[model samples]
Each structure stands twice: as C-alpha cells, then as structure tokens.
Target: MSWMLILIYACVFALTCGFSYWALTGLMPSGMTQRLDSLKDTPHFVLTEPSARWQRWRDKLQRALSWLGPLSSATEPEDASHTFSSRLRFYNAGIHSHLAPLVYLASKTVLTFALPSIAIGVLWYSQVSLSQAPGMALVLVFAMLGYYLPNAILAHRVARYQQALFNAFPDALDLMRVCVQAGLGLDAAIDRVGHEMHLSCPELSNEFELTGLELRAGASRADALRHLSARIGLEDVEALVVMLIQADMLGTSVHESLQVHSESLRTKRRLLAEETAAKLPIKLLIPLVFCVFPALLTVLLGPAVISVHEILAPTAQGA
Candidate 1:
C-alpha cells in the first residue's frame, strides 16, 4: 500500500513537470527571440537586464497559455460561426490575440481537469474517507466550476474595458472637435487624439491608432469606422461611428458635427454618473442591514444582557 501511494505521488509529479516543460517550450517566442539572438552581435544590440528577461519569460508563458484556446468539433460552417462569436468576445475583452478563443477554451479545459485532480489528491493525502459516489460527485462539481471560471473572468475584463472606454470617449470626442476646428482633417485629428490621449485613455487611444492603421492600409473610412465600432462593442461608440459615417456621406461640416456629438456624450456621461449615485444607497443597504447593523446591535446590547442575567441569577439564589 505504501509503495502504491509512493508510485502515485511520483506519477503525479512527473506528469506535472512534463506539462510545465511542454507549456514553457511551446510558448517561447522562437521567431522574435531568435531574431534578437541574431542581432546580439550588432553594435546597436543592448543586452537585456535580468528583470527584462524575466518579463519576457512571463509574457511568453501568458501567450503560451492563451494559445491553448477553445476546442471545436463542429462542422466547418458551425465552427466558423463559433469562432466569430468567440472572436467578438475576445475583442470586447480587449484581447487582440488571433488565438484568444482557442486559448480561452484550452484554459477552461485545463482548469476543469486540473482543479478536480488537485482536489482529489489533497483529499486522498488527508485520508478523507469519502465514498466513491460522493467523491466523484464532488470532483464533477469542482470541474464544472473550473470550466465556467474563465468565462466569468473574461466577462469581467470586458465590462471593465468597456467602462474605461465609455468614460474616456467624451474626452476623446472633445479633443477631436478641437483638432477639427483647428483645420486638421478627420484622419489627422484621429491620429493626433490617439497620441495625446495615450497617457489619459490608453484603451481609446489604441482603438484610434488601430483605426488609423486600417485607414492607412487602404480601408475605406466608412469600413474603418464600422470596424472601430464593432471592436468597441459600445452603444455610444456605435452612435458616434454612425454619426461620422453620415457626416461623411452627406458632406456635412465635420467640426460642427463633432462639437454636437461631444456635447451629447458629455450629457450622457453626466446622466450615467447621476444614475450610479442614485443607486449607491440601495447598493449599500444590504451590507448595512446584514453586516453593520448586526455588529452594532451586538456591541450595544451585550453588556445590558449580561447585567440582566447576573441580576436574575442573584435573585434566584436569594429566593
């Protein structure tokens, strides 16, 4: 029995080590790293510090893990549709990786198996005598939780990204209005705004930069604007895109349109802020009732209750 336990431990350790090695090697940026290596003898080549080296390793690990992506056994048509939806989710989350869907799926698969395996190992090591049926059921529950965890995290990221973009859009639009009023064309204004907003609103800046790149790459203005709206997945941004497209088609005054749009965005932002503030008390009510009130009541009543109990005990003794 001892030998069997030892063998199990050894097998688990070996499997873990093997997987780690495979992941590391698979994730390494061979093309980029090799190019760097070839350039190492050049005068301009600066050696990376230990921290930079570590960062590179960490980035590679992330990329590798992401590459494991979703598994699709559907027909080509179905797979394509699935991929499209997955891609949209990745885009919404600000994950630009071509393999994001696959990586997400892979992560889900790995966690679903890995978490339950770890749970079982720990249970066994602790010698918990769970019946086979119950034990398997617990493992399945763990697996299901693990499977959904990635999706939850991705959704959270997307929400955060959208909120950031939404908050930044009004400011960006105002800046664009200024640039347009100053005689910069739409393209130049976008590029200028992207550069200026980099420190303040990196997400918006990146989207603008990508739009600029698309335009430069020969995409039509309408198509590029549509793509930007699609990538952002925000109603406000979609409205802005539609407005810009209309302004272009109708040969309207870009500067005037931009100014109107900026004001509209500012009004929308203020409304959202007021709405959130209005809900704040309601949101806090649950904690105040369930947590704070209980603690306060305990502190306020505890001594009185103890005093009453003492008084009653002495009276009963005297009687």
Candidate 2:
C-alpha cells in the first residue's frame, strides 16, 4: 500500500512538471516567429508533437488536466475589470500569454489537491497512521498553501520585473533623450533604444520592442503608449506616457521635455537608493538583537557563568 501510494504521488509530480513546461514554453509567440509566419502562406497552430514515447503519455495527462480548467475558472467573476486586473498582473510579471490566467487558475486547482495528496502519501510511506498524523488539518494546511503558492510566486515575479524596469528606466530614458535631440522621431528612438537595451535589460527591451512594433503597425501614439502603460502597470511609465502625449499635443520642445524628465528620473532613482541605504541599519537591527546579540552574550559569559554556578552549587550544598 505504501509503495502504491508513493508511485501514485510520483506520477502526479512528474505529470505536473511536464504540464508546466508545456504551458510556459512557446505560449507567447516571438517577433521572429511572427515575422517568419507572415512570410508563410499558411502557418499552422497546434501543440508541438511529442518527441518521445513518454511525452505522448504526458500529452494525454495534460489533456486530462484540461478538464479541470473550467472548474478553476468557474469561480472567476466574468467582469471586465477583474479580467483586466488579472491580465495586468500576469503581463507585469512578464508573462504575455493569452492563456496565462487559465494556466494559473488551473495550476492552483491542481496544486490544491496535489499537495495534500503528496503529503498524505509521504505520511503513509513513513508508516505513520492517519490517526497519528495531524490528518485532515495537515491536509487542509497543505491545500491552502498550494492554493496560494502560485499567487506568491506571481507577486515575487512582478516585484522583480518592476524592479528591473525601474532600475533600467533612467538609463533608457537618457538614451531616448539623446536620440530625440539627435533628430530621430520618437518611434525610431524607442525601437533603437530597445535594441541597445537588450544586453543590459532584456525585460524592458522586450516591452519597448512591442511598443515600437505597435507604433510601426499604425497604432496611434497615444493609444500605443496607453497600451504600454496598461501592460506595465507602472505609475512612472504612465506619467511619462502622459507627458509625451501632452508634449505632442502642445507642440512643445519634445527633446527638452524628455531631457527634463530623464534628469528627474535619475534624481528619483538616486534618492530611492539613498533612502534604502538609510533604512539598512534599521533593517539590520532586528537580526542584530535576535541573532547576533544572544550568541555573543552566550559566548562571552558562558565560561564565567559556569564557573560561578560550579563554585556556588557545591558551597550551598555543603553549607
């Protein structure tokens, strides 16, 4: 029975890995792929063929998993605002797939059950009786953790993604400013700056590249920038978009306005850095008190305390 349970859990885990890999890869069509497809008379859209016998089994498992998709999404409200918020979260986290929300919700559903199942199997394999185990409570805890794990992961990704964009923005703005001053149109400057930013910050570069593509594809400047802001879900970028749109409308010196904004961004970045530096000691204080101080006190006084105890114990007993 233990072996059977272990086998079942192992299969569940293996299938999960395969499903995640399939879902994540090639979900977002690349620019190069799109360009190549445009050249083709008819480009087919289908799942990649399995390269091995095992993958065929995996494909079947994934198909079966798809049955749970409706179950997960059924709980989601059919409001546009909620859908937009969900889209914004995934896009800001750098996942551009149309299917990301579905994948995310479905994964949450699977994990809710899978984690508790795995835990139960492990306990069984360890020869712990269900009654001896925390049982249903432990199962519920694991289930809850699994349900929220993807959310935590998504938030982490969004934080890192935003940080990357924030850190890269000042330099990118400076480059764009230079390009504008050198007489390049805003669209050309954006595309060029995006190309140059690839090595330094691929994430921002990709976003800019998409914006540039939209511009070249005949999207209105205001609409393109708004879309960019929507995808980024960043206040600073949105402000920049508004500034540029206003500058365009007012016939103001775009180059000068951009330069000013770039300088402000640099200053803002520096101030943020200084503020973080100032907070470091406060951040370190907790660990210093909880971890370092106790260890230091123990080491420094341990011998003397032991000596005092040794001397006092025997004397008191003798007296």
Candidate 3:
C-alpha cells in the first residue's frame, strides 16, 4: 500500500508539472516574452572606474558578455499587449517569479499527503479499528486538498500585496512632491524618496527605484512612471502619474502642481484616518465583550458572591 501510494504520488507530480508548464507556456503572451528577452540586452554596470574586487569582476563579466554579442537577435514575432484580466491569467498560470510558484505548489502537495499520513499513523497508534476502506477514502481527500491549496494561497498573497501597494502609493506621491518642491529634479527626488523609505516601507521604494532604472535605460520618464503605477495596480499612483504627465505637457510649474497634489493627498490620508477612527467602536466591541467584559464582571461580582454564600451557609445550617 505504501509503494502504491508513492507511485501514485509520483505520477501526480509529473502530471502537475507537465500540465502547468504546457498550459502556462502556451498562455504566455508574446509581448511578455519580448520584454523578458529585451531585459537580457540591458547593459550591466560594475563601477569600472575603480572599486573593490567584486566590482572589478562584475565589470569584466559585463564586458565579456557585451563583446560576445547577443545570443540570438532573430526578432521573434511580437503579440499585442494583453488586457488586465489576460495579464493576470498568465501571472496566475505562472509567468512571474517561477520559483515562488513552484515552491508554493510543491509545499501544498507535500502537506496534503502529510496531513492524512499523519492522521492514519495516529489512528494506528491509538488502536483505532477503522478499516482500510475508510483510510483510502481519507487519503483521496488529502490528495485533492494538497492539489488546490497552493493556488488558493497564491491568490490570497496577490490580494494582500495589492492592498499594501494601494496603501503605500499616496504617501510615496506626497514624498515625491516634497522632494520636487525642495529643489530636486525628478530623478533625484525619486532616488532620495526611495532611499528614505527603504527601511520603513520597501514596496513603494522598490517601485520608485525601478522607475529610476527605466529612465536611465532610455525609456521616457512618463513611460517608466506609468509602468510603475500599472505594475502595482494602484489607482492613486496612476492618477498621480497622469497629473504629472499633464503638468509637464502643459508647461505648468511642476513644483506648484506637485504641491497642490501633495496637499490633496494629505487631506485624503487624514480623511481615511478619521474614518478608521470612527470605526474603532465597532472594531473594539468584539474584544470588549469577549475579553474585557468577562474579566470586569468577575472582579466586580467576586466579593458579593462570597458574602452572599457565607450568609446563606449560616441560615441553611440553622434550618
């Protein structure tokens, strides 16, 4: 039975890998393929002007690769950009961060098998009299759970990351405005804000750094910023980028425009805080009933209960 289970698991693993790779690779749009390919052509820097040994080695490696030319430049046919749902479909199917997806799926599969095996082992040790037929049914349930749990976890993580991005974006915009108004250019402002926020909140800072890199790589500032907003799927950042682009296009003073936007953003943040504060009573009520009230009642009633019990004890004894 153990050997049969192992064989079944092996077959299931193979099928999962084969089917996932086939479906995901087939669904990956050509544009993403081209974008990933272009990333290979990006020039790498290594502080060649004189630095540590690691830096020198990196420069040499980059130089060697540059001299060798691109491995293939045959110009693969490109597909049109996909809509958001289509993009998410590919991502969920395993286009982005391959290792994370594989690890998640593998762990889910292992846990599925592990849980039932553990339950069966416990039952055996407990001298339970469950028959083999019931045990097989439990094993099948475990296998199905293991197959689906990772996908559910991935969906949850994606949603959480999206929420964090939304919460962080407005602050990032306000910081950018402050830097711009304080006499820094866009690139300098982004670098400063990214550096400042690196320790406190990394997601928004990392996005800013990526935008700076794109600007350095010959992509226009607007394009890079728009891409940053799009990648995080945050509405505030998208609107901010649109405002910046319009300000630049219409020859408006960036500092003044950003100042106004920053004020508005701060107002929105304040309003959100107020709203959260207003909801505190509702949020606190559950804990008050479950935790606080019980303790309070015990404290207040303890002496009274003891006194009444003493009085009743004497009366009952006399009767």
The candidate scoring highest on TM-score is 2
Clash pairs of candidate 2? none
Model 2: per-residue lDDT, tens digit, 215-319? 999999999989988888778898899999999899898888878888888888899999999999999999999999999999999999999999899999999
lDDT, candidate 1, 226-254, per-residue tens? 99998999998898899999999999998
Model 2: weakest 10-residue lDDT segment is: 41-50
> Evaluated with lDDT, which candidate comes out highest?
2
What is the TM-score (0 to 1) of candidate 1?
A: 0.75
**Which of the two, 1 or 2, has more TM-score?**
2
Angstrom error at residue 53, model 1:
8.2
Candidate 1: worst 10 consecutive residues by lDDT?
A: 67-76
Query: What are the lDDT scores of the predictions, listed in order?
Result: 0.81, 0.84, 0.66
Clashing pairs in 1: 69-102, 69-103, 69-106, 70-102
| Clashes within 3 Å, all models in order | 4, 0, 0
1 against 3, candidate with superior TM-score = 1
